[model samples]
Structures are given as C-alpha cells and as structure tokens.
Target chain A: MEAAVEMKGISHWFGKVQVIHDVDLSVEKGEIFGLLGPSGSGKTTLVKMMTGLLRPSKGVVQLNGEKMPSLKQLRQFGFMAQSDALYSELTGRENLDFFASLYGMSRKDRHLRMNHVLDMVDLTAYASRPVNTYSGGMKRRLSLAASLIHEPELIILDEPTVGIDPVLRQSIWSELNRLRNHGVTIIVTTHVMDEAEKCGHLALLRDGRMMAEDIPSQLKSKLGVSSIEEVFLHYGGGARA
Target chain B: MNTAAVVKRILKQFHRDKRSVALMVAAPLLVLTLMWLVLDTETSAVKLAAVDVPAQVVESIETEGITVTVMDEAEAEEKLNEAEIGGVLQWEDGAPFVILEGSDPNTSGTIRSTLQKQLSEQNASMEWEYWNGSSELGLFDYVGPALIGFFVFFFVFIVGGVSFLRERTQGTLERLLASPVRRSEIVFGYLGGFGLFTVVQSIIIAAYSIYVLDVFMAGNFLYVLLVTILMALTALSLGTLVSTFAGNEFQMIQFIPLVIVPQVFFSGLFPTEGLAEWVQVVGNLMPLTYGAEALRDIMLRGSSFESFQVEVYILLGFTTLFTVLNIAALKKHRPL
Candidate 1:
C-alpha cells in the first residue's frame, strides 16, 4: 500500500512572505507520524497542505497515491483543527451528528458511530451538554470525537493537546496507540518533546525546513544525545551557526 | 446531502440560541409599536390640489402645513384618484367641494378641518368625499405596511450577518470548508435553514401587525405572508454576502449604517418621488424599496398579485444575485 500522505518539493508563500520552504516527506500507513516543530515552524501549514486546506505553492500532495484536493478522497481522513471549531450553543452529541451527516452516513450508522466515538472520547455522559459549558479538556475531546465520527481511515490532528491536562493527554495518546493498532494512519503535529518521543517516526522541523527524519531512538542515539530535545538543539542551534 | 447537514446544524444552533430567536421576533414588533405610538400623534405635510379656487384660499391652506397646487379640475381629479394629492378643492355653485384621498386619516382630517376653517370664513358650507379610505383610517394604517417590510429586512440582515460572522471568527467556517462540503452547499444550506425560520418570522410579524395591532389589511393575508417571506430571503442572502467582508461582529454591525440604514430612507417610509433624480435611482436599487412598495400595494391599495408581480420578481432576482456572489466569495477559503 502507498504512504498515507506524501509531499514532494513543497513550498508555500502568503503574498510574498514564504512560510514553508522546499521540503519532501512521506508518512507511512498504519503508523503514528509526528511532525515535531516549534511555533511558526510551518507545522500547521504543512498539515493543512496534506488535508488540501491550503494548496502548496510548489509541490504535489498525495494521500493513498491519489493526488490531493480530491473531494472523493477527502472523505477518507479526519481533521481536528487547533481551535475547538464547534458550535458552543449546540450539545456535544449534536455537533458530532452534524459532522457525521456531512459524510452522508445513514441514520442508523450515524447513531452507532456517534455512540462509538463518544464512548472512545469518554464524553458519553456529557454528550448532551452544550459545549459552552464544557471545560477546555472536555471540548478538546469532543472535537476529537467529532473528527472521528465519520470513522475515516486517516487522521490529521494539529496541536490536539495544547491546553489539556497531563492525565487526559495520556489517555488521548493511548487512544492514538489503539487506533494505530487497528491499522488507522495518524499524523499529529506537536511542539512538546515527550509527545514527539511517542511517535513511531519523527520529522524535526525548524524554520519551515526539515532538519531530521528518523525514529526517536535513532535520532537521539545517532546524535550522541540523551534526549530528543538535545538532538533538536544540535540540529536547530547548529544550523544557525 | 451536505447542504441538508448544514441546514440541520444551523437549525440546531438557532434553537439553542434562545435570546437571538426572541430578539428576531420581538425587536421588530417593539419598534413597530413604538413607531405607531410616536408617528400617529405627529403630523405630516398634506399636498392638496386647487381648481378655480381663490388664490387667497390657496395661500391660507399652505399656512396650515398643506402644500396647494393650483391646477385644472381634470388634473386635480386624476391626482386625487391616484393618491398623488391628499385632497382636491374645487368651487361649485359658490361652495367648496373637497375630494379627500382618505387612505391617511391624519392627512384627510387635517385637510378637511383646515378647509372647514378656511372655507367657512366665506360663510359657505364645505362638503367632502373620500377618494380611497375613510376618515377613520389612522396614520398607522397608512404607514404600517411599509414598516412591516422595513422591520423584516432590518432584523434579518442584522441577525444573519452577525451569526455568519461568528462562524468565521469562531473558526467553525474554516472547519466547514475543510470538509468535503462544497462551498455552494454552505450558501444554499444557510438559505434553506435561515429561509425556513424567516418564513415563520414573516408570518408572525404579518399576523401581529394586521390582527393584533389592527393595521389595515385590504388584500389577502396569504399574499402579505408571501411578500414578507420573499423580502426576508432577500435580506438573508444579502446579509450572508456582506458578512463575507466583515471580520467580526462589530464589523458586521458597521455595515448596518452602510447597508441597512440607507434602505430605510429609500423604502417608502419617506416619499422618494420629490427627491433628486440620483436619489430615486438609489432607492430603486434597494430590495426593501421594492418590498415596501409591494406590501403597501397589497395591504393598503388592495392590489392583486399581477400589480405587485414586478416586486416579487425583483426581490427573487436580488436574492439570486446575492447568493451567487456569496458562493463565489467562498472560493477565497477553498477553491474546490
């Protein structure tokens, strides 16, 4: 099978300020791929390109070997944006139902799928409550549930656990692991070091350029460093020198 | 199918927002009632026609805030029938005969009372007849139809624009565009959902104004509902289109002055005929201009559908134009 996402010679500019430089990367199927980058390192831009939200100025993005911006293939992946993009006035279950219907799911299947995602996100009890009343972490989990309501084969998440507590964050990571075990492809962008360490493969990005692409152990071991942060510092700091 | 999903989501959101729903229905009625109370006590200029009447009598009537135009009997009668002049004053057998265009009771009463005072000085009896409405028609009855159109347009524009802008600032619009839902589906879904709700609003406002408020209704109530619904749709489309340019709720409110306020000036609340040529053209461009005219024609004149069909078609045309522009604007978010 082809990689879940592939990008070659990708570059992007917003009205003359180039945000993403020439970069080539591929995400293999059925694995948790981490895009490790600092703020403004173009992680959001890169992931947006993969989801076809922003077309690259110069690159080809293919998902499952199909050239992207393909509406047919868009139904194959879920995307959770950085912000909780939900109607605060609507209950959590209503939000999920609305998203599921977008994918043209039938009523019975939608009910079943909605229940499954709500249970997985641990929001089953609070599902009927309006999202405005939800705490930050609960809203984050609800957003995750909405993205997964359609049960897409691939998922792209941007900063999914920024404001989340450590315990909930751990649960969310374990959920990712479970999904991967079931053969779902996942790509997550994060600035946190330990979260990068959890990925099956990592791409260290700085200044819109990929500094390194390897497994966490290989990247740290090869650099003679004790942690992913040191390996990142060597690449990021050395590049400036 | 995606459009239906969008429509469902919007309906759910609207239901949850009880304050907005109440504001949508109540605000218009409150303003209309307040206006009825205020403007009913106030007086307006009455234009009268004079045929073979003494020049001194014309000058005297003009002092009572009545504008008198000296013309032949034929022209005066024609203007009275068309409701151009408030009344016609003609001398027959050394007595004054008044033809009052009685659609506006305030105007007709003012003219009759003023004529009675002026003509009675000559020790002559003054007889008056109604050209359209009776002496019982209040000032509210004359302006009520136009007010209905204005309120519907105003409330829908504000409510629809602000909600759509919230969708943008809240990042839900980006999430929506990220879906496989087509841009046109978003616009049409807004239409379907908000359009249905506006239909309900239109019915309530129309019924309340005609039945509860006791505004005069000469035509079928169904036609009044139809015109209000179409006018609301026009407001919805234009509102969504304007929200595309507004970055926030405040910015959307700023458009009220630029978009909604001008419609008030042009929408038959004030007469547009005597205005400058370009001003009349500007009024012609406003949807409410046509809406108010259609409502007044149906409610006051008791006009048939064929008489106001042009306004119906024009309102639909405005909605279509705005909807197309809104769909095109979404291309900035996602090309496909």
Candidate 2:
C-alpha cells in the first residue's frame, strides 16, 4: 500500500539563504505525524511544499502515491497556514462555506459539512458572527474548522493551536485522534513540546535539518532522557528554546 | 465553478461595507456636481467703453451680450485704468484699434472676439458656421466625459487594489490558493464580482452627470455605459495587477501619483497637441486615454461605434493584458 505522504531528498531555498536542507519523510495512513521545530526551523516551508503551495528547489513530493502540484491531488488534502487565514469580514459559517465550495462540494453537502466542522471546532454558536468580532482563540478555532470542512483524507496544519486554551487544545487533539481512528492521515507542525508528545510519531527539526525521527517515548528512551525537551537538547536543538 | 463562491463572498463583503459602496457610487456625483457649479457658470457680461467711434460702429459693438458705453478718450482711459470697463475701443490711424484690460483671460478674450466680430461684420463680409458642437458648450461639457472616465478609473483602482491587497496582507489569499481553485478562477471571480458592482456604479454616475447636472450627451446612453464599464474593468484589472506589487494599503496609495495622476494629464483633461512625441506615446499606452477618447467621441461629437472601435479594442486589449498579468502574478504565492 502507498504511504499517506512521501517526500525524498527535499531541499528549498529563498534566494541566497537555504531554508530547508536535504530531508526525507514518509508517513503511513491512519497515523498522526508531528513536525517539531523552533520558529525558524523551516517547519512551515516543509509543510507548504507537501501541499504544492511551494515548489521545492530539488525533490519529489507525493501524497497517496500521486505527484503533487496536481489539482486532482490537491482536492485530497486541506491546509491551514501559520496565520489565521479566515476572512474577518465574513461570518464563520460563510468562511467555511467558501472553502467547502472550492473543494467542489454540493450545496447540500456544504450545509452538512459546514455544520459538522463548526461543531467540531466548538464554534456552532458563534458561526453566524463576523470573524472580525471573534477573539484570537476563536479565530484560530474557526481556521481549523475551515481546513477540516472538506473532509480530505490528509490534513496539514501549521501551528494550528497557537493561541487556543488548554481545554480547547485537548478537545482539538481528541478530535484529531478521533479522525485518525477513522483512517484519516494528519500532519501538524508546532514548537510546543507537550503538543509534540501527543503525536504518534515525531520528527525533531532544527535549522532546516531533521535531528531525529521516532515515537516520542522511544526518542526519549533512546537518549536516556525523561522528556522530549531533553531529547531535543540531546540533539543540539535548544539554543533558542 | 468555484468563481461563484468568490463572487458571492465579495458581494457579501460589499454589502457589509456600506461606506465603501457609498464612496464608489455617490462620491463621484458630488464631485461632478461641484465641477458643474464651478465650470458651468454663465458667460459674465462684458462692459466696453467706446471712444471717438462712429455711432454705427458703437451701435454694432453693442450687440446682444456686449454693452458698449459711448464716451470720450479721457473718460474711456480713466474707466479702463479704474478697471470699471473691460476695454477702450477707439479708431487708431485707419484701423479700429482696441486697448484691452488684460487682467482676466475670459473677459479680455470675450472683448477681443466681440470687437472683431462687430468690426468685421461692418462690411458684412464674414459668415459663421459650426461643424460639430455649438458655441454654447461650456468647459464642464467639454471635460465631463473625461472626468467620468477618470472617477470610474480612480475609485475602482483604489477600492479594488486595496481590497485585493488586504487579501494578501491578511493571509486569506494564501489559504485560498491552497485549495483546488485555479489561479484564473480567482482572477475571474474578482473580475466578475467587482465588474458587476462597477457596472451599477458607472451607470449611476453617468446618468446623474447626463440627466441631473446636464453635462452633455449627444450619443447613445447605452454606448456611454459600455465605455464606462470597460473603463472600470480596465481599472479593476490594473488595480489587481498593481496590488501584486504593493506591500500594503499605503503602498497602494503611493501608486496614485505614479500610475493614476499622469493618466489624468493624458486623459484629455488637457490638450496634448503641443506635447512631445514620446509624451504622446506614453499617453497612448494608458487605458484612460482610450476610454476618455471613446467617451468624448460618443458624448461630444455623437460619433458612431465604428469611428471609435480602435479605442474599444485597445481598452479590451488592455483589460486582457492586465488580467493575464494578474493571473501570472499569483504564481508568486502558489507555483501552480
């Protein structure tokens, strides 16, 4: 069976500065994969490449065994960028409706999926309110809702839970687990250590290079450390952290 | 297919932002009204002092609008110096020589032309004929077509460009690109949404100018709408293209002097006859020049579409070119 996501010898450069060094990655279906890194560790750039939002300077990116940057393949995944990309002038429901339609959802399907995603993000009550009136945490949840409205097999989220509170974060993680149990593949990028622990598999990246890739507990055990942060420190990733 | 979604969202946003809609629709009427008030004044009556001139000549000079006061040389000179009279008309040598108080161009030009018409008509040797517009056409009437084109271009450029810029700065554009939506779809979606709004805007502005303010409309109103709509689309596409380069709203404003104001000078507000060759070449490259020319041909001369088809095609070509540039500029965000 084809892996849910696959990349080989991926490298990217923004002008003279190389942001993503050579990297290889593969994630199996029905697994929650995490990319852990500091702010400038190229986590966003790497995830953007996987969605064909950016073309790598050199490499191949495939999702479900299909070469990316194809519109047909693009319909199979959803992306949420580091910034909350909701249209503040629109109601929360309208924002979701717009993205759902872009995925070629029917009107009836849009109504169903919009309500479902809004419920998943705990935004059903505030769905009719303009996003500009939403609080920062609310906006973050709404963005997450928009990304999931299409119900793609794979979802790529960049720092999805940045300003969200602990309770909502727990709920969101539970939702991710629920989706994973139903055979959905997930890729998430974050700098939060505890959040990284929730992923079934983690890749610790620093300075555009992957330092280690393993299950969270196994990574700590192999380094004889008690926490993922120590395992990160063990691999020279704590200079700024 | 997703273009409808984008269009629907834009219309909803416009509905929410009533102030911008008002700016686009009503502000032009206000400015055009003010321009009519200022430029459409009745020709102020010119008062002339006739000195040592024959009774028949003075009587001829005192025709319709011009009123000639019979006086001696000293009285006429004193009145002229006091600025109470516009000019001193006296016989010098064998010819009728007039001394004009040249402070105001309008009054002095009127005095000169009045005297010339009267003196030349003493022989009844000259006949006047108008080939196009009557002599009653005011400054407002002459420049009204261009101003309509200008306002449509200016407001649409600012509103459309800034709106597109907000999508970039607010990060929504990147999110939109992440979908299966094609780049051309996004461009077409914006064009359709804003294009519909501008159509209504242009009609309101054109109707108010022609019917209420009474600026001049000799040709078909439908053609005027057609030209104005094309002008608005040209501005819309150019605005989106410019937004691709603008970093923020402030940068978009900065383009007014660079991109818009020069078009005003070339847009038929001022005569380009004496301008340099290269300068006229630059004006030909601007979309407003063609729009203004097409508008004037239709509004002033009542020319048929065949006469201004070149301008029509050029405006369409400009829109197509800018729209293509807009779609290509999206590549900066998403390679596809």
Candidate 3:
C-alpha cells in the first residue's frame, strides 16, 4: 500500500535552463514501474532525484514518505546509473566486493551474493579479469551485478539493458520480475517498446513533462493501437500539453 | 564501514593500475637522479681562453684551470659568447687588464681571482669568515633539502589530482555519492589510502637521497621523514581539491605549471634573499615554501621541531584547508 517513491510538482533547473518541469509521479511498493522516455526527456534527472543524488529546486522528492537526500533513506536503494560507473582498473569481483561492503553486508553474505549476481549476469568466468578488458555488453552485465550485490529493498536502474545482448536482456528482465515478485520495487527507465510492455506500470514522458501514466495494455487499447510504440507516440503527441 | 570500503577499493584499484604506481615512484626518482647527477658532479674544470695575456700569465692560469685555446682578442670574445671558454683572459687598458667572461658569478670569480693571484701578491679583496656553516657544504647540500620537499609535493599532487579527477569523469564519484557513503568520508578515505602510499614513497625517496645519493645530511633523519610526509599530505589534499575544478586528466596536468612550478621558484630551491620584499610575502602563501623551510631547518640548520613549529603547522594548515574544500567540492555531485 505504501509508495516506494513519490515526486510532487518536481521541477529542476541547471542554471537558467530548466531540465525538468512541473511533474508529479509515484511508484507503489512491489510494483515494476517503467519511466519510458526518449533521450533528453529528463528521465535521468528524475531517476537521480529518486535516488537522492540530486534535489528538486521547486518541489519535494520522497522515498517511503521521508524527505529524500537523507542518508537513512539512501540505504534502501540499489542504484545503477546509465554510465556503468565502475572502476575499470578493478576486476569484476573486486568491484562487486566494494559495492557489497558499502552496503555493510557481512563477509559471508557478500561472498554468497557476489557469486549469485555474477552467476546471474553470467560473468562468473570473467569475474577475475579487470573490467577494462570486458566488452560493452559484459560491462553492462557487470554493472547490473554490482547494483544487485546488496539485495536492497529498491533497485533504480536507468536504461539497465541498453547495450545488453538479446539473450542476456531476457534473462535480466526475468530477474527483474523475480525481484518484483519478491517485493523489491524496481524503477527502470527505457525507450525499448517490449521492455516498457514488461513494466506493470508505465509513465510516458516527453521533453520534461509526463504525458501518460497507466498500464501498458490499457494505454495501447485507449490509443487504439496494438504496439506500445504507437501508444507512446500517441500520448507523447502533446495530448497532456 | 563505508569509509573503509572506499579506502579498500582505492587500494585495490591502485594495485591493479601498476603504470600509475610506477609513475608515482619512478617519475620523481628520475628527476631527482638527474638533478643529483647535474649538481653532484664536481664543478667541471674551469675553461679559460688566452687572447692578449702574457705567455707567463696563460701558463699560470692553466695550472689552476683549463686552457681551451689561444687566439686573438676577437676570436676569444667569440668563444666566450659560444660558451666554448669560461672566460677570455686578456688585457684591456694595460694594468693587466682582465677582460673576463662573467656568465656565472662563481666561475667568473674564480677566473678573476686565479688570474689576480698569479699576477699580483696583493689582490686580496676581503677576508673570509664562516657564519652559519663551514665551506664543506656542496651545491647538492644547498638544494637537496628544498628539492626533497619539491618532488614529494610534485609527484603526490599530480597523482592525487589525476586520480580524483578520474573518479569524477569516469562517474565512480557519482557512484560513491549514490551509495550510503558521506562526502567527507570519501575525502578522508582518499587521505588514508594515498596517505599510506605516500608514506612509503617518502621513506624510499628520502632514504635514497640522503644515503644512496650521499646528499649532505647533517641533521636528524626522522625529522626529514616527518617533513616529507607532511609535505606529501599537503600536496595530496591540495591536489584533490584542485581536481574539483578540472574536467579531465589533461586539465589536471595543466595545474602543474600554474601550481607546482611557482612553488618551486619560491620554495627555497633558489635563493629568495635578494628578491623583492613582496616576493617573500608571496612565498609565504605557497605550502611548499613552508615545507622546504621546515626540511632545511631540520636537515641543514639542525633545528629541532620546536624551532620549526610554525612551518610545520602551516603545512598542516594547508592540508586541513584543502581537505575541507575537497569535502565541499563533493557536494556538486551528491548535494547531500
């Protein structure tokens, strides 16, 4: 019943140029919410606010009804930003161990979880190799593994599967669904049509504003289109302007 | 736990990046060795050119110095310009005219007095008196303590700045901020890990310069180590702080000319005694100035810690200010 993340009238500015306009969004606990938007749609900014890395200039961002940018609330999040953000000089296993320790996981827990995530990402063999030697897709999988190393209550992934191979993408989506079933709220940003279909709840955004917020089937039917892409374009066609 | 985790990760990263590690040690060692070789060589035999000097005078000067060539006055002047000769010993107006090349004061003084000593028995200009030290001090003795501070500051500043800047450009800094780690914790974590590395580096460099290179060491070795470590911390903290303004490693490299080069000029590497009064005030603003002075006082002057307490405290002061600014700079990424 509780919302995992809530944004009320959130507007942000970088100097004089506004990157995010007045927008209201919320994701309930245990649901797979997708923030579907094209590039420069302010999805990254919104996700950053959700993770408490940035503060809204005009409005409030809340996690579990507590004001964000709070250290206590930050512990609940496992954030995977778009840029991998990994130490390329470090081996994959070392990166995982580092992230695991930051969450204060026990040695035994770290050992087990590191293995589980590395196995899930199918990077078990290359775990000992430095990340710089990894392919782009391998790096993405490794980034995903690092985010999930702590098994936090919420996982915020920004374009989590952008460069992932199709087979690995499917496995990652299934893993995300498994996390959802286990009551871990996930908020992912993507422009992929099928990936948006996988989210239980989707918010269509254009520019800095949200165009629609609804289930994928209901949105497609309401727009009289079978594909999520048409529904995306239909709602993003200035209907909410 | 978060700070320790950060320290561990930095150490792990450093272990993996062997080139950077090698650079932190080797770059400074190479420069230090080159400088040692240059200054350590006994001043090469002074070269003299005989133009219009009497034959007996040329013979006497040769015994004290080297004879590059015998030529006319015009030819000797050309050799002086090309540095082929240290000086042209020749007559000008007739009273044993010594038209000497005066590029280097030390060499010119030697040439002038050597000629005068050979010619007249009464060219004694002034009496010599020993003040703070004896004449046993070599050129390396004068520059060694100051140069020790310089290299520590230099290598540490560059390594710290470029590494911290990499954290930003590579997005690991954002990654750290997104985690439960505090901004101050990140800064302190860097101080711990890099602090340890620089400690090891200081020991190696100071020991090598004092013992291996045989640079004149008169005072306490422990004090040299202490000053070296503090100077390293100052550079490391200041490097991290300045890296906040740099967007990439190249930008961090750009800081060397603006920051490191000026400190060397004022850090007692060269004599600042005859410089303008305001220049001395400017020297006070540089962290290396205090570090070099502290090192000199400990090694050259043999002054105790209590005597150089002000300089030590100033080095520590720079470290603290830069660390606080580094923590503030992190707010740009996390804002918490």
True contacts kept of each: 0.59, 0.80, 0.79
TM-score of 3: 0.85
Name the best candidate (by DockQ): 2
Better-scoring candidate (TM-score), 1 or 3 = 1
Question: Candidate 1 versus the native: TM-score?
Answer: 0.91
What residue pairs are clashing in model 2?
none
TM-score of chain B of 1: 0.88
Candidate 2 segments exceeding 4 Å error: A237-241, B40-125
Query: What residue runs in model 3 are displaced by over 4 Å at the alpha carbon?
Result: A239-241, B40-129
Give candidate 2's TM-score. Answer: 0.86
Q: List the residue pairs that clash in candidate 1.
A: none
Number of colliding residue pairs in model 1: 0
> How would you encode candidate 2's per-residue C-alpha lDDT over A20-107 as one tens digit per residue?
8899999988899999988899998889888888999998999888887878888998788889988888899988988898998999
Q: On residues A1-241, what C-alpha lDDT tens digit does candidate 1 reach at each position?
A: 6898999999989999988889999999999999998999999999888877788899899999988888987889999999999999999999998988888899999999999999999999999999999999999999999888888889999999999999999999999999999999999999999999999999999999999999999999997889999989999997789
Docking class of 3: medium
- If scored against the real structure, what TM-score would every candidate get? 0.91, 0.86, 0.85
Point out the worst 10-residue segment of candidate 1 chain B by lDDT: B36-45
Clash statistics: count for each candidate: 0, 0, 0
